[model samples]
Target chain A: MAPVKNGRYLFNEIPSGYPIPGQTTVYDESETIDLDTVPLNGGALVKLLVVSIDPYLRGRMRRAEAKSYNEPFKIGEPLMNWGVGLVLRSDSSSVKAGDHVYGYFKFQQYEIVDATRVLVLENKEGLPWSAYVGVAGMPGQTAYHAWKEFAEAKKGDTVFVTTGAGVVGATVVQLAKADGLKVIASAGSDDKVEFMKSIGVDVPFNYKTTKTAEVLEKEGPINVYWDNVGGESFEAAIEYAAKGARFIECGMISGYNTSEVYQVKNLMKIVTKQLHIHGFIVTDLMPKYNPEFYSSFVGRIGRGEIAYKEHLLVGLERAGEGILDVQSGRNFGKCVIVVGEDKA
Target chain B: MAPVKNGRYLFNEIPSGYPIPGQTTVYDESETIDLDTVPLNGGALVKLLVVSIDPYLRGRMRRAEAKSYNEPFKIGEPLMNWGVGLVLRSDSSSVKAGDHVYGYFKFQQYEIVDATRVLVLENKEGLPWSAYVGVAGMPGQTAYHAWKEFAEAKKGDTVFVTTGAGVVGATVVQLAKADGLKVIASAGSDDKVEFMKSIGVDVPFNYKTTKTAEVLEKEGPINVYWDNVGGESFEAAIEYAAKGARFIECGMISGYNTSEVYQVKNLMKIVTKQLHIHGFIVTDLMPKYNPEFYSSFVGRIGRGEIAYKEHLLVGLERAGEGILDVQSGRNFGKCVIVVGEDKA
Candidate 1:
């Protein structure tokens, strides 16, 4: 290796509107990879095999005055994000070199990282390795923990999910269904709706055409709404939500690109029905309570009690396309970048 | 005494828009008050004094076929609603005559009610009787229970209340204040802002001038948002709300009159922050769990540890003005009708 160096995609400038082509402004390719030999505290560096593209990342690229969950992507710094990787070398006791793990690496081929913010890809032989990046990964955990911890979902209860075709959403729909709740979802396209139905959503509505209020009225009432897409969908969910409902607002993807949002018509439904709407960060939920939740969830998936679809993209070079696809609702399931297959 | 019969304000026609001046017909002056003398089994006759004129009532009036908190107002019959009254008679032995109570009364002066759903109001003299209709009542309990039970508020937490000058918002501000939370409120007018400040809000902003997100950013993070005025206020609250914040949706007054509604930006904040925005109705909170809460609440009010303000419209004749004032932000506090004083 000729004088190893950091390889990362920097946020050149904030994107306007829906982050059109070249809006992310991926920087130059790295001259040398940030190898494991670097003086990182806990573990050796790893080469990123697959990176995840999420719609929420667009929010961080904007010029925010204060920091949110992870720091807002700095104007001139490489956009910090989550990824799956193969450890090239190890310095920590828990994880070893060549061990496939899911961690928050940079948007690059290789990253010098600490082991604290990582999972050892437990039950690796027990489940698909890529699953550690999909349903078994952050997206999977997001849906599972949110539905399990907050929504207070019970069997026979009705559960509605906004953006029900996305990674977190699809996962929520299946999990809620597995729990014996009648699951309903809102997707951007008719195709996504059909896809959602195939995966066990009792009803799937195209948010673009079907009015959220109309669907809720048709559906009558829902006990919990696992929100992955906010805005008009949220407002609609407010109107249709059952009495004493719980709204776990996981994301508001619908309002990310827009400057303003659609208001809810029957917001008072919360006070009158005794509904609980709470906002939380996955990172806060992850270490604090996700272990037992995800473990059981993964068990559900393994036992065929739940199901999901995977929308995969090939090559690290296709990372930009994957991100764009997610932002546009073109990716129905987990949009993952395939760098290479793990031989571990 | 004339032939006495039960009276009720019936929904004559669905309101296409705000009833055109005199389009809202009233049945205040009536002598045939009681519908029947013999209490039918499972039916109770309630003499209602104070009825809630909430913005949500407007949605229930729309001609569209849909299920709501209550069935939509029939084309020519009475609208069943929330109110406080004296139980004139009860067919069920579970309740006795002359019991102070509240329930879904017909929007009228009196009605031979079905007793099955009646909730007896016990020991209500500790606080202002009007509070049973406003704060310490539906609106007040709405604010307190949702904040305490759903939001799980803590001292030093920051709370954001929309429509802070309105009945529900006012109660939320006072109750959240008692809880030692830093409270910021959104008012439609400068006077309302001042009123909110006088009542107890740490800071009050005119929603028309200052934006919720901008002001919320300056006030520090919001732990909970009691939303009564939906639209821009709610959208901004989602963006500006702190991590792990709970948003209690109570009403959508801002766009209740218009065909068009305001849109929000940054809905993605909900997922990233993991926000819970719940829509509820107060009738569902377990009465068994609320006695202690009500007692402590009333004690605080009686001791002046918590003080409340009421906007009383002298008679039922001006009920429209009172309702309009309450809806339009003209009323400075909880709007009520002085039907009669409490006497055994």
Candidate 2:
């Protein structure tokens, strides 16, 4: 065949705190990869379909010297993250050309990757292809695992979820509610608060207008705290936590982009209340829980028991903007960059 | 029996931050309690020997409206705490007049208390009467229970103890070392650091001079963090914690007296590192661990396998100063106020 020009978003500079537009540069013709070029030992030429934009990607924009779970993105290299793609060509028996796949891959329109790294998506079951990058994706799995393993969520237990309208938080809210938990969710705007309420959240408050402590005192003595937005919200949860409460530290989006850290004063209450604060990454649970995730979690989504929302940005060029939108709480749900239409 | 004139320290005023001298008043001949005015049923008249001055007492000095596990001290009433005492008079079957006992009692020269509230000391074993208030008492039990139940301490594990030379911290240091764990301890003074070193702490740093993060980085990838002096030290521990590390939040003595809370900036690492931070009050474990604590922990103390230090101030009049000293890290080891000679 012929050579194709690949459009990719490159990490141009290390951000001081938040990533600005200049830090991520879009190159429409960053590289040319010949379709004839196949792996010497069996790899795949994948065309990117949907790319996920998450809060954690912000940490990758920092200097390489900054220690984190994920390595910093190398300047002048294409950003790499979890995304769904179509196998344009394959040299291995694991996957064939035109097979839908999902795994860790570069944030580019087209690329050649090792076939073994990507998993072939077998069953779509009338769901949108973007669902694999949202509800049945990393973020959804994170919410499920955190709730199952870390939350210790019980029926009739009152749970407070921060960033309640966002992807992971929204999933957690629905899961908790479905499991008979009394859900109180916090969002940044009136619209987001309404969205949380519409999803059967017992009490949804706009955190921008209401003091978290006031809402907690009025509606809480929270049994489980599903933390997505940390800092002041975390402090408030500590103050309002019930005796023997479990605090699931899922994400701290509030402090990820800013240098100014919120000093949590009520941590002492954690002792007085006998609180257990646990931090976790979803990927760590994949080996054990992925099977259950695929069977039970996917079944729940298929049966309409699980509900999900997505904020899609078309084109690879808007990948940086999608990340910034998620970081700034401008996106309503699971933020994704729709690089190409699903041709399957 | 003659009427006894008691010298008592009364809680005069609620403190905004640290308790000032005037907040606590030493009233000599405060009240005349006639031995004849015994309980309508049965009671004991006890003369205080050594009163334990602890950091938790700071919480008691707050306004009555402030909710806490322990009740606030009533203004103009004698300050009450854990003290070892000689029973001057008893009308109950549990003990005689000459018997020594230890439990929660008024911080005065003499107190008329119910017989059921105190436990008679059966085995002194050549240990100091003050040892009942220190090493073999509440503080020692606290250290033991915190380590056994909370720390999840294992051999070869690198454990970091804050306030390393203080009562609870010193005990934790010795216990961790005895368990075959590598111990990194932080103290406030050069003398305290030396004390920590003498007690087999693998690395002891004065947190006042050297940055706790600096010392932790130099000596750690700490597995178990036994936090006593919280605030900055706790923040530092969060920074250097290893993945799946356990942070036993025993106390935050550093923030107790001060209104200014330290903003813990590195708490986000708890998620990245998959840390479990649990807060617990030692009293909560008393029912479960107290028997084992009394048997094994006390046996260890008696055998000299356990070492303890005390910064004892003479007389109940100096109770306020003793508290201030402990709060400021001016006094080393367990801060105890020796109210009267033990005539056992």
Candidate 3:
């Protein structure tokens, strides 16, 4: 068989700050693979359907020696993240042809992968294929576990969630609202703030124009904080936290691309107000929470009780642009790239 | 009944930085009280025996309007803190003449206080009277509950503790050692570091002479951090914290007395490491933990399985100096003042 176009995105450089579009990560249509003749060797051949572009992927664009929870992206190789794909051929029992699967998928149209690396996805609820990589996926699980276990939230509690229009924060904001909490959320743009308001956020503000601390001081003594964009907002949360406030530190997107990271001045408030600031990665809790989250949240989302939003980028060629959109706060909701045709 | 000398310490000013020994807090012996026939309406007339001087008091020295976990000390009034006292006279059922008690007692030779405020101190282990205000009291409880509940510790875990020779840090160091942890403790003085070693600390360093971050980088990726002094050390702890590290924020004495507070730069580590930083007051957990702690620890101390230390300031005239000693890191152990003879 002649080598067919694979169309992959490669990690080109370790970013010093915000990744440069087309330079830090590059999409090369010239890359190809022989699907029919390539050696499977007890592995499965899969056609990538949807690839998730998330803020956390920015942390992976670092030197291999830099230590973190996730391994650094290998330069000149396909940059990977949570993705859903259609199993085209299988040499193992876990996944079969025509079955939809999800796992840490590379940014490419086709791949030969270990059968064990992919989990067969059963879309019995008949939701969008992209939803599996969005609300019903990593972001949803992160919001669910961190909010349920660490927020220690109660009815009538005032919750402040940063990055309110983003996938993780939007999920938490909705969860808090459903649990009868007063939700105050923030976003970089006015349109995102409007989206937050549409979803029943009690006080939604554009942090670009409004002072986070002023809003919190006037409308809060925040009982719980779902922090995604950690920086000045984090310091403000610390300053306005009520006694025994719970802080769920999911992401620090504001400081993710900057060398001159924000210095938190009010950390002393942690002692003065007896605050509880907890940081967690969703992967750690996924083994226990994924099934639970999917079981409960999928139906709610299907029935229109919980809303899920996405910013979709079509084709593998746009993968680099999608990630830059997410990193620079240009993308709204759960940013996803459609890499191949969704045959499912 | 003739008037008798009633020596007392009064709050004279709101300090800008470290409390000035005689100006911020003053000891006056010119006032007198009628001890023979003092009014005791549903209260008790008590003779102050030993009064505690702690770093946390620096927080209470603020203006009355500054909200914190504990109320600010009222200016022009007798400064108050945990004290052991002898009941001279009583008009309530809670206490009687000749009973030894402990409470938030005034810094004076004699005072008429609400009888319910003071609890009868039954020294079943035959410990020193001053021990009730030191290791067997609030500081000890702070160490015990914060360590047991929040540290999430296991055997052989490396633990870092700041202000290692102070009551809270010393107690936590001993507790971690007993739990089979590798204890790394820091203090301002070489003498205090030696004291930490004597109490079974595996790694004891004088933070003033040795760089805290350098030592932590060399010997640790700290699994549990019992933080008392929380400025530069707090930042260093965050930098060196292992994945899933637990930070027990009992006090921020480093920032308590100053307007120029330290800015923490490495809070991003909280996310990358999935850390849990919990700040709690000993008062909040006392109901559940105090009895449990006393039952286990008092016996341990009595049997010589645990050791206790004290820095005794003789006479009521030295109360101001004692507090300054605590604030400035001059106190080697639990700072306490001998206000009157232990008539028990």
Residue by residue across B172-208, what tens digits does model 1's lDDT show?
8887887799999888889888888888899899978
TM-score of each: 0.80, 0.94, 0.98
- Give the whole-model CA lDDT for all candidates, comma-separated: 0.71, 0.84, 0.88
- Report the error of model 1 at residue A61, Å: 3.5
Superposed by TM-score, candidate 2 places the C-alpha of residue B171 at a distance from the truth, in angstroms, of 0.9
Where does model 2 exceed 4 Å of error? A21-23, B88-99, B124-126
Q: In model 2 chain B, where is the ten-residue run with the lowest total lDDT? A: B21-30
- What lDDT score goes with residue A156 in model 2? 93
Pairs of colliding residues, candidate 2: none
Question: What tens digits encode model 2's per-residue C-alpha lDDT throughout B217-304?
Answer: 8888999999877888888888888888999988888888777888877889988988998888878888999899887778888888
Q: Per-residue CA lDDT of candidate 3, range A70-153, in tens?
A: 899999999998899998888888888898998888888898889897878788888888988888888888888888889887
User: Which candidate do you rate higher for TM-score, 1 or 3?
Assistant: 3
Per model, state how many residue pairs clash.
50, 0, 0
Which residue runs does candidate 3 get wrong by more than 4 Å? none
Better candidate by DockQ, 2 or 3: 3
Model 1 accuracy (lDDT, Cα): 0.71
In model 1, the Cα lDDT at residue B228 comes to: 77
